[model samples]
Target: MDLLSIKDPSFLKKLSIKDLELLSKDIRKFLIENLSITGGHIGPNLGVVELTIALHRCFNSPKDKILWDVGHQSYVHKILTGRASHFSTLRKYKGLCGFPKRGESEHDVWETGHSSTSLSAAMGMAIARDLKKEKSFIVPVIGDGALTGGMALEALNHIGHEKKDMIVVLNDNEMSIAPNVGALHNVLGRLRTAGKYQWAKDELEMLLKRIPAVGGRVAATAERIKDSLKYLLVSGIFFEELGFTYLGPVDGHNLENLIENLNYAKKTEGPVLLHVITKKGKGYKPAESDKVGTWHGTGPYKIETGVIIKPENTAPAWSSLVSETVRRLAREDERIVAITPAMPVGSKLEGFASEFPDRMYDVGIAEQHAATVAAGLATQHMKPFLAIYSTFLQRAYDQVVHDICRQNLNVFIGIDRAGLVGADGETHQGVFDIAFLRHIPNIVLMMPKDENEGQHMVYTAIKYDDGPIAMRFPRGNGYGVPMDKELKEIPIGTWEILREGEDAAILTFGTTIPMAMEAASELEALGYSVRVINARFIKPLDEEMLTQLFEEKIPVLTIEEAVLHGGFGSSILEFAHSHQYFETVIDCLGIPDQFIEHGGVNELLCDIGLTSEKVVEKVLTLTREKQKRV
Candidate 1:
């Protein structure tokens, strides 16, 4: 059967278990082949093929809302919901989204990209369902890794206490980016061999009955310890204590078992939790053996031999550069420690973890907790490098504010992927860190012009001993520039002049520096003296240089690969006005006041008019506008 002919999950109700198994094989093949060309969360999607099929077959979607936590695993869900033909365009600009998008299909009841949101979203939907008196099942499928999140735990407490008629499917794959850490993961590991939940309870009762108490104080104490023993030995008792009707340790890849368990969950009341154990990369051999998270989400790879196809770039990745630099500094600086929110592989902190096992901490899937933990380490006068992606850092804003910034601790935050990360789309875009982190008091924000500057900035951030300094870096490889033999600490709050001019000024940082230079060069060839300045330090605003620009009365053009609102560009504007430089011609160019979609980085840059062509036009216009004003 043609997988492309799959219209909707409605057709699945008519299929037998064997037919569904065949369909799962087809779905896996479709994902492996298509994702090889397109590049996506193939491992996650492959893992959930049978589980998603079983879900769609068991529950009536659009009416019976099914929410996928962290959304990357929803590719299989999308295929089942009449999106099989759109596989070729997966994660491309204006094409099929990698994550569940509400606009794409009505079957996508909830949109997600970040983790641990499904439970809360499901509770909200369940509340709405009850208020309207609608008869429907609300199922939220969340990974075990996501369960470690504070928000998910909070939601779990509420959902259980409210006794909401919902089914929470805990997809325990034992890996989230890398292997999951924390006590919760251990609990699930023990639960894996503890047999069926009811059997564990009965077995515990049997053991309790045979304790051989000789009618003494020991017998009364033994009777009192019955409930405590269940918490210790019984399977799924952790969820049972949370007021959920615990079910499973069910095999997620098994269609028959999954369907049967899902049916049982539908019949049960008061928020049943079906703990389905799955393999991260179920079907493909290369992905199946992924001990690290290389296959979690990947670029285009060769299907036959499982070699990920990447362009030969001599330049080191931004993540590797920063993490390696930190590791280098950690050898000399005894106070330095590392923390990441379940992104050891993504952030390239494996080297750091290997070198200093005691100092490194991988706090799984809890960004807020990771931030606070960094803050906690800071209180002990320990230099904690809180490595996190820009998008995920948004989740820890309050912790950053209340704990890291408000307390004025020395936490060196290495902001990874600090620009428009192309393929992962809006939810994973690192564009808003400047906008969010800029306004916070007692905190310094900066981004590097290149990998060489990035390493120096990492050194600078570590040595500064200032109140919460963050260095933002882009996602991909650097410009492959010559590195200085010795590392140097750049003076805080100072901007670097890459090229000088008199007609106008182009001030930008990070990935946009080259664009600024290209625009400046074009303007110069056309007989315009455009100065290109790398405004690396986002905060403090290079006031001395701004004064010089104001005194010279040169038209200023600020560019960034970030949101325009409250971003670096906005900061430059605010400085000019506040310092009584009202006559100074200033223009800001960046990602417009909208969410950027998934595409190639260059394609996204062109789409948002962040290219050198756009920069040249902006500069020419600004200079012309200034000439008229003069």
Candidate 2:
């Protein structure tokens, strides 16, 4: 019963159903208590406790690969695989990861953070297993919401065509982050209540047997009619048509039912879709009652009252500032519309949706479609604001280039969580947006120094009719800066001078601005007059200011909270080389060429040498080089 001492899931196979049920309760209690302190995907993990136990009991994990889609619900899997002892350090700096990691344990066969990837990964592993003549099951536990993704659908088609021997556990909880939408969700809804279809089929077979005295022609016709009736009555026939043996709308929480259905799926030939119905946040009332998906992922909360523990009197969240600004602008401009890829809650677009439901659209996890939809709106002279996270925007890169950028449409992209999202780790980090979006033509990229400027930038982006423009903001709260009564447009290709000095210039924007200022002040104390420039516009380099720096022969140091390669700093280097400023001393500071792991934003920055100390050192080095050349 001591969950912390659990070494592996081998003990699960020996336990009786009653013992397993008790263990499931213990697991839930452990998760509720531990995650309340550490904070995690509580609802998802709670939902999967019994199912995960059933899985471990049914299959040998390290041998039989159990790939988890999105990996958020892997906490139970982690605990069973001897990771319960690491709960205290979950999502902390260089500690236990929030998602499945290949290095964490051999049981974690595949690492994933994004949704709808497990099916494809499972297919590949299944193929490899067949090639090597290995005898182990390939199970990919996918959510109903994830099943709607374009990638998942594509995988479903391919796996069905190939008829690979794998068990596809369709975890139907009727939610994915937010309440699921679209036609597939509707079909699953019908299937959830189709338990009587099996009984109907049996009765039909008995009635057919009673007509044995009929001619062969009539018997064959009756058989055909019964088959047609089966298709009409059974909701899982859709998957059956795709070459999969359809089983269950089994109760996921019931260990006996789960074990029975899982065993059936394992024994079935070719691909089998085992539809298991589950309740999201099964044991916890607060999470169970959650309708809008607020409890899907959460911060630390009180176990007694379920009240989220939050810092008091903090600045507005960056998402709220941006979304509210867009909402405010939408009141004045009828042409302005908002779109998100099933992130209405995360993007903080509820205000806009409440005010103008017709103008707000949640496209339901289809990033590619959302991008092209925005482009389509832009082509019709409608100003569409595509609100998306930096990491997810990677899914729509082609749409951004081909539809929005190539057509030169006026699309406003609000890139939220633009840099170093703390808890979600490498897969969810927003560091690569600058590199990915910078090289795309007809796209103007910028980040604001503070929330006040952020609102202004939002205005500027919506008003810019030339082409696609994006304003990226960080994950957490904005700096509590004063607000202006009216929003105004900032000129494109311009940088703001925060401080003036003669020794060197520090160019940076967004979350890195404060560090640059601190570094400059520290340098001033040491008798180095370092100028600080807010390089707000990442694309279309500030030609006038850059030329002034080159003419003055000021050594330059660029800082960014993004990848160093093909980022803002790289753009600066390209500018200097193109402008015949070959002799200018330049240095750059940013995230190194590696995937930053799970940690606090500050800690990750420190690890990569993007802190003020690094900035000061770089400034000292660049100025010293300039002095040596002089």
TM-score winner? 2
Please identify model 1 stretches exceeding 4 Å from their true place.
199-236
Give the Cα-based TM-score of candidate 2 against the true structure: 0.97
Candidate 2, residues 113-179, lDDT tens digits: the string is 8888999999999999999999999999999988888999899999999999999999999999988
Q: What local distance difference test score does each model get? A: 0.90, 0.91
Pairs with backbone N, CA or C atoms under 3 Å apart (clashes), candidate 1: none
Error of 1 at 427 (Å): 0.5
TM-score of each: 0.95, 0.97
| lDDT of the structure predicted as candidate 2 | 0.91
| Cα error, candidate 1, residue 50 (Å) | 1.2
Clashes of each: 0, 0
Model 2, runs deviating above 4 Å: 196-226
lDDT of 1 by residue, 1-630 (tens): 687887788999999999999998988988999999988998888888888999999999988999999699999898888898998888998899999999999999998889999999999999999999999999999999899988999999999999999999999999888999999999899888886764465455666556666435445666455566566667447888898878778999999999988998888878999989999888999999999999999989999999999999999999999999999999999999999999999999999999999999999999999999999999999999999999999999999999999999999999998898998898989999899999999999998898888999999999888699999998989889999879999999999799989999989988898888888888889999888998999996889988998889889999999999999889888888788898888999998988888888899999888999998998888888888888
